[model samples]
Target: MSLLFVLAFLVGPPAVLLTVIGPPIRGWPTTDQLRAWLQQPLTEETLTAGLAIGAWLIWLLVAYTVAVRIIIRLRATTAWLRRMPLPTPLQATASGMAGAAVFGITTNTVTTTPPEPPQPVATGTAAFHDETAPKDHRDPAAREDGVTVAGGWLPWEVAEQVTAAAALVWLRRRRDYQPHPTHPDDTDLTPLPPTVTAVQAALADAPTTPPSDRTAALLEALPIGGLGLTGPGALSVGRGLLVTAVLAGQRHSPTTLIVTRATLVLLLGPAGETLGRRLPLTIVDTVDEAAQPLQPAGPAAEEFSPGQRPDEPSSGPNHQTIVLLNEHDGDEEQLTRLAATGTATAALVVVLGERPDGPNWHANSTGHLHDPHHPNMPTPRLCVLDQTAATDLLTVIASPDPAPPGLASERPPLPNAGPPKLSLPRQVARREPPHLSTPPRQRLHLRVLGDPQLLIDGEPLTIRRSAGLQVLVYLAIHPNGADTAQLTDAIWPGLPRHSLTGRLYTALSELRSTIRTASDLPVVNHSDDRYRLNPAHIDVDLWQLHATIHQAAANLTHTTTAWQAVLNAYTADLATTRTWPWLDPHREATRRRIIDLCAALAEKEPDPHRALQLLQDGIRIDPYNAELHRQVSWASTELQPWDRLTNNHG
Candidate 1:
């Protein structure tokens, strides 16, 4: 395509010239005659030839103008395509299914029963809400099977991304605001596992709005894990399919998968035994065991009963209980009875082969499912994971759950310190104060607490390539550096590793060159196959915020000033508008810390008006925090009756 443009640009003018001044075989002027006509002064023949030449020149100009316009349009389209995440239906479904799985595991509402509203704490400082906590916009949708986002079907990937992102946020909030007791003994110091972090990075730019009804329906209709497979290698493929479904189903809810022992080994190989024990899955011996009343798998799951959450109808899709049975194990009579019982209990019965009483979709080795009754219909492809992929996924699911960033000090009120004191402790010492007043003019400025921007000596330096900016952001997040594999996986998730090596190098080179040209410093340092930003040469705002937070913790004598410094340092949410796939967890973690900071500071403030203002600021940051709202109410009550009414109404 570019060659065609070059040909048109370079060849068109010469062709026109040859046509205008070639030998007179076709009534065209000879070169000598054209020269004579140009040399002549104001003759009619000269004017006619000149006009003819001028017309050709004008034609060439018009062609070039149209070509330029077309080039611009093509470039614009190419950039748009690069920015658009979902380009295929299969990828969309993968994202949605993965998102749903993430949602299931990370949802905050995880209890056997609907919890009552939170009452005030005994100390009267601030009462944290339990299950009755004011829900965020996406919390309800996250609990359901389908997550809806605003807009048409075109942005359904955004819907899925939003679901995954909301789950992550809820998970973090739960860890921060409402720690669950289900895994009381489970403790891992790391903020999040690699799989969860990758998923968070994959869906970082999801819209803040909750999914819309139309979008939710569209997502629900996605044929993620098809009903059943019965082709040549149907059982093998079906195992992967069923396993995928189980993973997705049990993630956020207390869902269970009941499979026979033989079928479990066939599905997950030797790992099945370990998985069955670890996951909320039950491996049964025969059809008789399958028919027995099943237990709730996880903390949120409840036994399928008559009365639980009376407001919610029994028919509603509250939770899932899937039963996987082999054709050989169950007789026709038992299978029929089990199918009926499954329907009554809102359970799904999946058979290994074509069952007369079950949903039997045939699948080929390629993972596309076909309805035997309607062969002419379009085949929906199932999300089939091979042994390796499925095992890896299960391993991630089995990994230790996360603990919130700062779990040790998660109380609502600030610690009991009388006031800022003048004396400094023997062990405590203060470093030089951070440059909080203004951004340093002479040094490199890397600001990612808002929109990512790199400024050299106070002047904006654009990193022309998106990948280049991504490299910078990745390095900013991991100051210690990242190897080639980590960088590729985080930046380009599912792309072939071999194919991305060159592109990765180019992005890195471009980043280094751009920074070097602007600042005359090697911003990116490569050592031992790992790439990181040169911390000595550059000053990142995120790092500054971290320092401020640490200082606040150490310097208790200057409590008020220190807390305010932390707030001021956090200019905005980390990388505000930019939605890099890997930024969501980091962003949410920082946001939660800030909210905690505000609440703690407000609790310590002695002045009623000042305390109210502090709590209000925290509310602005996180409006749905029921604890913050309750604190606001408590603070308002401390004022005089008239002031209280004015504050409440205002």
Candidate 2:
């Protein structure tokens, strides 16, 4: 209503006055003649008559209505664009995908070292399938088409929608998509063997509704179309088309790309080393090795062909194989035979040189493809990946599978490890006061022990990006500071430093700007390429908790007071509800220490009731701890007799 009033005031008066002022200004009547006409009686012929006044009133209403509708239409379009799920180029890139990996979300094991003897810690596994269920955007069960195709060649709106829909579908399938289980603590970083589920996840989401018939045609032609490339950028162009086909393979019919290890590296750069293990790729050592049909091995082999004999031809209606070859290694006879087999089999085979009988596209050094055979046809833009783009995309594709439920099945034996010894430096412990000292209140307070939040004085400050908040949490854990590479590994694991330098820098810059804007103090300090929070300006609760624990360890005389302070400092588990891959170690370690502290305090308590309360606190954290349960039972027994005697006396 307020907006309408403002619009009316700006436009309504000017529009209404046009009727009274328009005709005379256009020379229908002179200024003197117009003034004289107003003095005339209410006659039908006069301009000042009642009929003329009524017509002008109707004109004002019509003009206002049109203006209001136009304004509304414009606003609606703006909002729609704002809400559109547009997948940026970054989203398809390696760093972008790394950020999307299911790190600690569902059920995953993380190794954390506590006090002296190492014990396997179980961070309670969440329900595996529940979190990965199909979101509201699209139904996962509606996978008639095998894999969604990457629609990078399509228009902006079309491409992003395709990407988002594909991601949702992949997530739905990922719940049941388990590759062979490998130990989480394995030292080897080599990519594992491929599985059917792995291939499906690597492929794009099948479109629920395509934007246009032309897009549909383009997508359809990608899997079966025998594409050949020639000229300066043939390898690059062919690589793009191959990646697109792999991403777009149908769920009912999957596509396997066969290429030599050398060619794969040339096509995708350094990322090729990891891509073969994640995507639907069968990488061989030589071009000769690529000529053979794919044989399923281990569990994947059984999943691929259950009843069929291994010696028989495994080709079925459900499989689509695309073999990528180099021109240098191919002969005329081999190329013709390969091309003929592809046509008969309803499969695709892409080459880096001109084929004898099919359409061969020419590529320029700038990574653009031109169809010389049919100049009139639209030259669909191929999905070209440079080194950085390849790394980012591979990282996204290589996102670790959601760990299965009931992880950490082999629990390490927990010996009666007495009270935890503080791992603080001797000099630092001596420098600390006997009692927990209160520092002057700082303007910025970063709390990460519970639900992570940053506040300026008392009011909560909002950080726009999740990465920005993550930086604060990571820095809070490492008070001394961390360099860029270390931060990237922690935040976006498996992404190369070169690919995500800008992303990391942007997060740091934005966080610094936000903090300075709120508190007018530069809380984040960067020098020698290391970033750290300025403790003088910003106060971290995690740091304070450690200090109190250290004070308790150093001064046994003030242990009772210090223990209480330690309890007060630890409000909850670190970054509760967050599932960063790097957070599990810190979160579990802190939780164990707190439980130990509770037990230590209870053992010393003289009053049975006080000891019972302390034991209850420990049980609240570790409900599965048998020792804590035993102590609680003993405390209850001690109190039972006293309560019965009092009742009888009353």
Candidate 3:
């Protein structure tokens, strides 16, 4: 509202007065009248009115600024309110109505004069009708056709109504359209296999014949209404279609749908039929039951029963089955214990709500007992099911199965094979390379033990462990050793003076062992108690990487060569997880070097495609880099012209 007031005072009033009163006042006394009016403007009444208008305009402008600041603060404080969920249509409608209301109110308050009708000129009249004609004016009908033939103030009310109505209609249409839902079934599922033939063959070999009317009876017994198919033949087709539809909806491969559907039908149909014929009515009822009672507990229960041993065969009815159900709570020890007791013949069911890393049943290859003491103990046949499927699967397992003629009279060999092997081709041995005969090169072998200690080459250098390594690395970095006392005090500030020498000896022993193992070079030598890493014997990749980076930095304008040099020097982060007091500064310096190289390449490379590729590779190493993104954006603009047209339009 204050903004409107400021606009009205500064612009609206001047425009209105000039159009409405200026022409009339100018004509009041012709030349003589204008001169008189200008002379009269020094009157007290005119000055008072002018001063009052200026003061009101100034106050309105200040008020507008204050109001804008208050609005910004209010938005900041209640920002979360914008994220609160609201019905889309209601939100759209409210927005539209608010905009219309604001436009209507503002337009009503602002007064605008109607433009005067254009005077038509007589083609050849002495009356000077041509002199009064509006410049670039056209007939009213032509203007009404939507062409702006003349310039003049447009009434605010008409413009407001037009804009508000258009906006309201657009909002209403947007609210009317429904957005499509993202169905989980629509996701790609093309990675499964089909086994229809296997299922049919299993069914055909069953010993007992199914009743002729069995399929019809089962269809009638189905809980769900209106299955279009009945009987064995119809049931097969219906099952196939149902499986296909489910798989298709899930976007799975057609082959996978066939295999999974066939498997399901074999399990639920022929397998169920064979079980039904053999089991007594009472046993069938028990098998179909939902939950089993937890086994009774006693002092003797802690020990395995004679037949309860995983390998022991039960002497009860051949069909009698034991179903073991275990839940994992993510304790590795508990999982190990459960796995140790399971046998191959025992049906082991594991119910897990979350993935247990490294120690879960899925991670076990043999599903064998986890203990060395029970190495020969048979492990259970493992079945993993989510919570919802556990009850049904458990019931099926408890059910008695009639020994179908082909119930594998003999158990098949286990499928738990050992590690996969590569097939190697026959080959002849070759002579050794020339470099193999040379004695091992003398180099520093740095060995880090437990915490802070470094062995330089093979000899135990007499220097503080922390200080010696720092001095060695610094020297390895600088190509020159530091003063002994200077290095000692740098690493061990405020140390007790007496024990410093003893501590330095221990540190030097560890450093010597480390350096000897790390390289075969006599890299470290003491000259007047000052230690240094022999630069020639050390094979540090850091030096090479840095040298290459320096070379690249020196030749930024010749980017092709510079980029190649940087690429050759690139390596995975140095001792990425290891931390040292001195390593951080070096790491940071290397990072800055790489960044500078990238900047130089970005500036010198004329081909945006090449630049974009370089930036992308850099991003892979440093994902959070902002400079890479900036370079990518610039390169994209350069590439945009190539994609301007499509062949289809032509």
Candidate 4:
């Protein structure tokens, strides 16, 4: 207070002196004159000067306080960044320089042109002071085109550059850093192994808004569904095909989820990019839409354009799916209708919004969508054998056939197995041959020559007994199928009719259940006392082998690749643990045909060595078959005409 009083007295006197703009007084003023001046009302010049000085001082005090606070905060922020688990940004310098360069280029501030005389240099380079140039002198055309005025350096330009550099460093660190997976013990993520952990960390780093400056890690982590589910291998359709293959043993027509248009846009292009653009996703809106049957009137999936990124690849027509945007009502009648009828050809996948308002389509298991409203929900997103949650209820239906505590088999044991010792020979569970490289999504892949095995999605099934497996094989061979009596006679020829019926029923039931669990489809279908594999759900290698061999035999237009494919198909004989007696007859017939076909192929082949190779392959498949050995011997004995002629000349 004392210092301020002294300073105020000195400052006021000087300021008052300056306002009395006149010749300096030669002598001290008289006491009476000074008293008279003080007594009179203060002049406007003196009052104005006093107010200006006081205002300036107040502003100085406020500015100093703010600067102190800012410095304190900056130090704290630096410490926080240093302690973060992610790196503190090696790319900050490069990023800042790039950004500044872009800004300068856009504003016409970065140039080689020299500034006016008395030019000051920054960093030893001639500094270009753009402010001196008149607004009209700068490219008037470009200025009109929304180019912001870059009139040299602003008071805080340097500070702004420093702050921006800091921000960019933090952003890069966050984008690239993968948080340790919190829910490592999640059951759904178990099958994914290391891929699950990686994908989870990526999802954590990807901000829901997906800023333009997001690092490469975030961009790579973005889901393919964001590319608008077009072309071959679109995640929605690919997963749908995988589902179809699992359920029906075929990836024919895909299943599609009619997404509301607003939600659909988030998965695609730049709605998220445009600042201040809020997607119209709300709980109330969804509830209102899901209540009624969706007519899907807004726009077909055609409204969706290809991905905006130049590097993103365009997919094919097969990947083009029509999901109706903004079409559902609160009751979720669209999904309910789809689930009830099962008539819709394509499966539905909810890509962008909250789960359907109603309970009809509740089982979702699929990918990470950038939901704008709940940008930072901290929960572990999970998928079964994949990266995202599945939206299909049918997917959950694939849950392992209900295992109860100390569970017993539903059907009784096969009647023929002798007593307590030979009762349940539990070796029928089939696992895929380690050699075949098929993905889990492919249903019903078979490998039978060395060890007869049935694989559903690369996982093998084991039938409890050889007889039950034989029944499945027999049914596979004859598509038209067999009557109960025929199957009974085939399995138990001398047994009584009643006993055969009991045993057959038990075996058939167990086999059906096994196929259902493995392929998610019924392999054996019984109708009007006749049994056969459900035509739509079976893919036997034996069938392929027969077709390929026949194709080779009918070489009306022959090609080397085709013959090679034929020989490849016939490389192995049928069934290793020959349980079914019925297969032997057909197996023999097929082997003879393949041997004859191979011999014919060899006869037609131009190269004697290739022909010998084919003959050798044929012998290897059926070594003991006299005809195959005989054909091999004949092929070996027969010599080319050139060799015969050379011998005669000798």
lDDT per model vs. reference: 0.57, 0.55, 0.36, 0.41
Could you estimate the TM-score for every candidate? 0.52, 0.44, 0.27, 0.30
Model 4 segments more than 4 A misplaced: 1-442, 556-559, 627-631, 644-650
Pick by TM-score: which candidate is best? 1
Residue-by-residue lDDT tens digits, candidate 4, 1-650: 96586567546655654566432334676898678768874878546656766755665576577669779889868845643332124344545656676666678854685332332222221121221112221111111111011111111111122223322322332222211111111121111212212222122212222121211112122221222222222333333322222222112133223344343333222331121022112122352343233333333333234543211222322222323332233335654443222112212223222224321111123323232333463221112222132221122323232335542222212222221111111112223434546653345755555467777767788876555766877665565778888877555432346646877777778777877666676667788889876545557776666666655656624636766787677656667445233444445545555555555556556666676786687666556544445555655666466478778999
Q: Which of 1 and 2 is ahead in TM-score?
A: 1
Worst 10 residues of 4 by lDDT: 146-155
Q: What are the per-residue Cα lDDT tens digits for candidate 3 across 1-650?
A: 97687666567655654554342222234787457669896777556556656755675676688679789888855743642233345445656766776666668756665344334333221121122112212222111111110111111121122222222322332222111111111111121111211111111212222212211111111111011111223322222222222222222221111112222323345353343232221111211120122122333234334545332322222211122112222245543333333222222212222212212222132111122234453432111222222222212223233334743233311112221121111211222224647765544333321222234445544433334455555554444466656454434432334445655666666666755555545656778767765544554445566666656655645667776777766655543433332343344434444654565455445565666676676666555555455556666775676445433356
Model 2 spans with C-alpha error above 4 angstroms: 1-225, 241-253, 260-262, 265-280, 283-319, 365-367, 387-411, 417-443, 449-452, 462-474, 482-531, 544-650
Clashing pairs in 1: 104-251, 104-252, 105-251, 105-252, 148-211, 148-212, 149-211, 149-212, 201-581, 201-582
What are the C-alpha RMSDs, in order, of all predicted structures?
A: 21.4, 23.0, 39.1, 36.9
Winner by lDDT: 1
Instruction: Give lDDT tens digits, candidate 1, residues 598-624.
Output: 655555566667778877887776676
Model 4's lDDT to the true fold? 0.41
Sort the candidates on TM-score, descending order. 1, 2, 4, 3
Better of 2 and 3 by lDDT: 2
